[model samples]
Target: MKSVFRKILLLFITVCTLFVVLKWDLIRYGWQQARGQIAIMYNAEPLAHFLENPSYPDSLKAKIKLVEKVKTFANAELGFSSESQYEKMFDQKGKELMWVVTAALPYSLESYKWNFPVLGEVSYKGFFIEKEAIKLAQQLTKKGYDVRVRTASAWSTLGWLNDPLLSNVLNLSNGRLAELILHELTHDEIFIKDSIEFNENLASFFGQEFTKKFFKKQLERYASELYDYLLHLEDRHTLNKFVRNYLPRFDSLYQKIEGLSTIEKENQKFYLIEKFKQDLRNQKFKNPKYTDFIKSEIDVNNAFLLSYKRYSGHQELLERKLQTQFDGDIGKMLDFYQKNYDSL
Candidate 1:
């Protein structure tokens, strides 16, 4: 009996070790595959044609131009490293991950098509799986929005998956991308789990202010191109609009929820979740009646929803402190954030 038990224990240990070994390789391969595909699609002629084609809407073309500008600024100004540098940063083995770019053509003004790049799927959980963002892009395609999307396992999603998550960067402009890269890199510098609001708020505050300083420095060298640069600033305007519109309502709902009893709270939670759709409908953000999914998706009032709210709220205060205390020095701003280490 003792001999038999020892044999079983040895087998279990061996299997567990094997699983760990396999999972690491799987993650690495997925990252590499995603990276390679992005590089290839960006360089492909078909994509180039689609990007330049005049038939595409002028606004989208402008956004694409913005993307190019952002990438240039990100690579040139922000600390975005070369492919080799990325490999070194991640301790990669120099294997390139392929990213599948999906640029949807409009079937109509209300609808768009999805284009999946060749060789796009990556290994996840021991199986080859299509990326979730690609899936979302496809679904939106069916609903109609002139969606041009892409799929990559390795490219950063700017920590939107975590609480206090960064608002997603769905087909964002260059200015947006630069901010995202900074925010995510900051996470590597400091992270506190289950505090999504604090994490994201810190990142958002850090990234936005950091990028401004970064751009200011770049502007000194390229003084003639300031107008094109300010176009990116318009993105922050849009973000502020989004925050102002949503934050008040979210706070009101949170206060209401706080006053309710446990049973009442849960019941109210369900009711409010449903009512969020109506609120969105009333605001004309979208037609609530048009989707197969509604109640499950409308979570604007969730406690976790406003992880970044506190930080976003105190942003001006923090900025004021930085300016008053440090005379708007970028290095000092970095040091202050790093030292204070509070969520807001």
Candidate 2:
């Protein structure tokens, strides 16, 4: 019996060792692929492609124009932020490498057998292959979650979830790449496990706020375009509010449909979706080219997604409270968020 136990232990260790070794190669390949992909995207699109996408929502396209104007303004009039000097830091300095940019997926039967080297198991509706991400958006919509799904050739890993297998940084448009790197690095600087909502909200808040400073300093050159840039900001705020309002209704509808019979659920779901479109149409957000909510497959339980989306809305409120109580600094904010979140 003792001998058998020893053998089992030895086998377990051997398997673990093999797994680690295999993962090392995967990590290497993933980084290489990620780098290569970023280079290719940059080469093909040249940053201008995203701007020229005829399908890009006018609101967002306007934002991109602002970014360019900001860059020009900064260089010409405002005098560049010495910080922009660090822009090159996020790029692949040597050979174009490769890495995976992935997201945790809602549970599905269609699991990929492959592991992402340092990142562990690959899940469905995740962002490894971008098409799958689009599919995921559609699926999540059917499940009654409101989301705006956009694809980009570049993304960042933020410091917290450093999976060596995925891309550390991507070659993106100057404005976009900067945002991705800052956002990802913010995660690396401070991350809380199982609190993706808090993590993302903080990163997003800081990233945007910081970008405002960055662009403000950079756009000194393009004073004439500053008003146009501000318009983009106004549009973003509008869009964000729109998304927040829609999410709650979608969440309520999802809960209502969860236990219904198949036919009943379908009938109700279609009704809700048509209503949803009508709401968007009423709000002037119904861009036919961009709006697609196909009923392909629906797994009704979406507590994870609901919680994440809902939490983002509340995080700011919580953060503001913390700021009032303890002044606006990161450490205090984190403590309050963690303590409050756990208590809930």
Candidate 3:
């Protein structure tokens, strides 16, 4: 019996060693992510603690209260699950918490995807360490893929962990803050595997719709603010339309260059992209808020354009469904989607 037990222990140790050897990269990445998440959770303090701390500013306290109001509205009215989210806060202390990297074929709109265990396939990879994200982006660029790296304001853990409100976001205006919170809550309520575009579009649609309702409920107090926000939404809508209109043209251009050399194809791609940026700059918008945004797209590539498409592609269809099928009832639409996400 002693000899048998010793043999079994040796086999167990060997198996674990083999597993570690086989999955070192994944294990290391998982450890990095887990460590970052744990650090945030450990540093977070309950909302009450901050509210009661006299050293905390009144302005920040007001934002904290606003966060609570947004969460309550999302739960009671928009039918999103709270699940203890936003009950605590993490101070980013002026640093970005995460960076997301997206990649695409230089000559095509096809997004490069990353597969994880439970989340399945996702088009973007997130890194808690900025240098890690930049390293991946550099590697992808060397591999001839168009890559874009941007700071992420927030992301859902899909209910795996209670997400805390980051201190950096408290600088957003009330309406913008409400939109951000509602957007994340939508993810908590409904997520479909391997359908990132649909998930993001659904969240954005609900975030905008619910924010409108949230402001409309207190129109007397936020009428001007609501009006300005609506104009901002209009600018975004116009931009989405502009991008949608150009997608087919981009596809056509790519198809036209099928037989060209790689260098020639890249040249043509940038030429067209430059032309598109110029046209975008020439367009009239409802607000001047996007002037700097338009200028930033001068370096736009397939990855950047496709990233925008992921969030806005299905928005019109969702809006039509909301108005026609759900009679503009956001909650009912949410319920239908939540019940039928697998089919979607």
Candidate closest to the true structure, highest TM-score: 3
lDDT values, one for every candidate: 0.46, 0.46, 0.87
Q: Against the true structure, candidate 1 has what lDDT? A: 0.46
TM-score of each: 0.42, 0.50, 0.93
Predicted candidate 2 versus true structure: per-residue lDDT over 148-173, tens digit per residue: 44333333343322222112233233
- Worst lDDT window (10 residues) for model 2? 104-113
Q: Between 2 and 3, whose lDDT is larger?
A: 3
Please, what are the lDDT tens digits per residue for candidate 1 over residues 20-114? 78687555655755564444434434324435667855754554444345445545644443212121112123332322323222221111222
Off by over 4 Å in 1: 1-172, 220-314, 339-344
Clash number by candidate, in order: 15, 24, 0
CA lDDT of 311 in candidate 2?
Answer: 28
For candidate 2, what is the TM-score?
0.50
